[model samples]
Target: MEATLPAVAEELLREIKKAFQETSHVPDELLLALKFIFGSSAVAALDLVDQHSVSRVVSPSGRAVYQVLGSSGKVYTCYAACHFCTCPAFAFSVLRKNDSLLCKHLLAVYLSQAAGVCQELSVSDQHLASILLEEEEG
Candidate 1:
């Protein structure tokens, strides 16, 4: 009855979310834990969060998506539900070779969510659909 790695990670994220709710910042120990768990992705993800580059876009019907603006100014779409990111790093590292758990963009989304720092935007369902289609086509 041992908890799996993913379960442990999810629990840790929940704890981080609670800390964010209480203090508006992750504690140093939790930050270290993230770094240990995620390696370089943790550092880049924190930088993205500090830069205010992660966003949560939602529609009236409750559909939502995550977006992260990379250092190169390209926006990457991320789906939290599937742990999927539309970024070259995600494709080459996370999916293709399986060398990483997530791309920096996906990690950024997770960190921003846990820290409650993502820019939240509400859009019409049609607009959200348009955004999804545009990302897919591009």
Candidate 2:
């Protein structure tokens, strides 16, 4: 069986998207321009990332693996330890580039995990096993 994300996860993604769309992802140069105008400290691009877009799901027994849906509406299975995502962005940017960089899905997962916004769910052992197998086979 497939592991499922909660309704809260989708809602949170929407909220994160909305919040992120406004005054977000401004590069440091833009921040520098703003700072010059306002005489304030410059903000970095990383500061604008919305960590709340991702929602993590765990089994009640803490043994299931869950997939995350991205802002593009695609499901990406992520392996935390490897800093990997099944998304094309990871394959092209991180894996192909031979670096530890992350795609948006992986970044969201990491950020959400850090912010404690990942949602945990109850799933069967098979669900977790299937996810792991898919990762391996993929």
Candidate 3:
């Protein structure tokens, strides 16, 4: 079946925003690409996250918990959290680049945090599995 670009783009934008809200850094080029692909809608969503201080958290086994701030001010809790963005663009890039290149979520989060979009968080990872598992279930 032929996929709708707008629908796909919308999904991509949501995932990117989710990832950004939960991660610390997003790549610059990826953000630009999102803007190019999704335009103002994507930017507006990102702006909301930034305004709200949403954060992403990640906890990989045997690593410290990482708290990531999104460009839109959303916060994610965990260690190595970008692994969870759920954005097609990010998934494609990770699959195509073998995780070598940074994804758009990472770029957006980085820019957002740098701009003081939200508060900083430092947490431990032993409890991160629950967070990751929760996402998996959704």
Best by TM-score: 1
What lDDT does the true structure give each of the candidates? 0.87, 0.52, 0.48
**Over the stretch 20-135, how does candidate 1's per-residue lDDT look in tens digits?**
99988889999898888778888998899999999999999999999899988999989988888899988998889987887889888888888877999899999999989998
Candidate 2 vs. true structure, TM-score: 0.54
lDDT of 3: 0.48
TM-score of each: 0.88, 0.54, 0.38
Give the higher-lDDT candidate: 1 or 3.
Answer: 1
Model 2 bad stretches (over 4 Å): 1-53, 64-66, 135-138
Model 2 C-alpha lDDT per residue in residues 1-138, reported as the tens digit of each score: 433333543444344444445644434554344344323111211232242445455655675343667656666787665556787867886678753344656545644543445676666667667767777887
Tens-digit lDDT track for model 3 on 1-138?
322224644465455556666674556766777677645534654664466443544334444333444444444442234333544444566566553233445444533544446444444574566555664675
| Between candidates 1 and 3, the TM-score winner | 1
* Predictions: Cα RMSD each: 3.3, 11.7, 11.3
